[model samples]
Target: MKEAENRACEVMLHAGLLPQLATMETIAAAAGPVLEPFVQYLLRHISTPRGVDGVSPFELNAALANALIEGEEALTGLVSLAVSIVPLAPAAATTNSSSLTAATSGGVCSVSSLTRVRLTLHPAYPLNLIATDSFLNLHTMLWTLSLQLQWVAQSLIAARVCLWKESQSQKRSGTDNNTTFSTTTAPSTRAVQQEMLHLVHAVRQHMLTHVENTSVRMRRGIATCGSLREMQKQCGEYEEELRHGCLLHDTSSSQLGSRKWHNHNDGPAASASGSPELHSSLLEVLESSLRHCILLGHARQAKILINKAKQAQLEAEDAEQEALALDSLEFAKQKFSQITCAVAATEREFEGHRVAFMERVSVYGSEAGAHSDAARALLAAVDIQGRWQPQKGT
Candidate 1:
């Protein structure tokens, strides 16, 4: 009886239960009143000369101990057998002081040495196996879904690029098609821009899912079930995981945008971006900030972009409007010939405003150094998060 109770206590202790809670004295005291009778009956049966192919108590106990201590696979099978027999062993189940819950006809058996060991050996392993199996079965379907979504994002980007280029080309061609386009073209263009914006938003949103999942798993991996030292070790690994992933992500994204710019806009094809030095420096700073944000797990310079861009856009709009008003006035100056001096001064002022407006647009467009920097920052955020995958097994 003491041996059986001791074995049960050991199983509980290994399963992360407090040792004091499953102490030998407590278990023995708890099982004494009811367990003594079952033990006596079993002993009497085994001792009988005509015992049904009986095994000796010493032999049986030795075999059981050996199996429980060394034969993990066999022990697990025994535990399953015990759980299965719980319905027929109501009294035996009730007398046991262990904590494993196995449902049975009479009630529930709460003694499972096997389950405890399996859980102790590798808690994450079982969970990983289950998740991986599920993922495998559905991976093909998920890939199809991902491809469709990627197609949408790519299509929207391509369309926006095409339309923007076409608009610039038309302006360069001295086309006066604005009058013909007044009916539906403006609305259609707006719709396309809106769709493109929606697609960008969707892509960004989907990227967040991967980041969130990675965060959750990292937290879980760092969670401690043992002592403080173990916890610290787990936490250190988690931090390393975060730092490495962030740095790699930031660097990779920066390089991706740099390569794209080199291929499309930077190579001698009009040198869209002005001030190469400023552009390169800005990109470096932005990329650094993005890396900092990823490692620290928070946005660092997102506000800087917001504040700067807002101011720049406002100034650009005001300048653009002033220039347009001056142009209109200059066009209608024949009737007001007396205001020729005013018109000339206004034209000079408009030219100044035009330069300022161009500077701002160039800054915002692929032509300005700031554009390259901002593009690197934003794309780094998007691209890094996009390619991120939170997998198990480190």
Candidate 2:
């Protein structure tokens, strides 16, 4: 009997069940009388032989099945609780512990933690094999959980970029409508751009850390789980996908250049018109900002910014045209004033010459009257002729 008990303990230890059973014993002891019935039941089952007198084989099998179900439930609950607590744990924990915490908090899980968990569960292989359907279901659940966690981490980073872009856009909109020029907006815009660049860089760091950890885990899994060919392949594919997805290949600069070129050529007449050139340059800056937003995965905010920029460009063009028209009108008024002054000066000079000609004719008439009738008649004829004749220039 003693030999049989020793053998059972050895099997339980090998299966990694001894620690869990020991933990339960400790809890039961702490609870004292409250868990007495449960403790007694477990002890009785452990001590009882499979072929005891009146116990039917079928009944014995049923009890063992019940115990297995209960044990599975307990393990599942414990794992869930641990996962829930990890995010709230202090950051100074061991590397595996800290990584596990980060994973629960929507950050990458460490390769070491993943490997440890995988190896620790190896003792349950015999039980899992005995219940193939259940094992498959559990595997699927674990796979789904890991994928979901990874997605959550990615989404969290994307969300931060979106929020930052939106806030910067709001600040821009709050400025005076006439200040769309870079001279007015450049300093603030540059500050926001720098912030965004830093954020993207941080995201890249996180992604690299996650990818490296996943690669390490994959190598270890491949080395140890030789029979799990399909699983290893799937893991490899997932890791590759993550590496590609998380890589921050910045195409914003190129995209901005292309977009600016397109916008500059969008309207030849407008671009050629010097008055509206300011608006075109402003549009280029706005389009560049929009492209940056799009690259960072802030589609909704980018859309809003695009619409605002378009409206601002149109308004700027109108203002520039109005200014040009006002200048032309002022120039015309100045020319009209100069022409009027020159005409008044010519009229004054002609009036002065007419008065002098009248004075000379009166003097000649007085001198001719003193000479004779013939001379007077001659003088009167000359006066008539002078009055009838056209002026020298005419």
Each model's backbone clash number:
2, 0
Pairing residues by index, what is the TM-score of model 2? 0.21
Worst 10 residues of 1 by lDDT: 110-119
Cα error, candidate 2, residue 384 (Å): 99
Candidate 1 error regions (>4 Å): 1-128, 138-142, 176-187, 203-207, 214-394
lDDT of 1 by residue, 313-360 (tens): 555557776565445444333222322233233233323322222232
Instruction: Tell me the lDDT of candidate 2.
Output: 0.32
Off by over 4 Å in 2: 1-6, 15-132, 153-157, 172-394
Query: Model 1 scores what on Cα lDDT?
Result: 0.31
Q: What are the per-residue Cα lDDT tens digits for candidate 2 across 150-259? A: 32233334545654665676577763323221244334434445433333233334333444444455444433332333333634454333322232111221221222
RMSD values for the candidates in order, in angstroms, are 30.8, 42.6
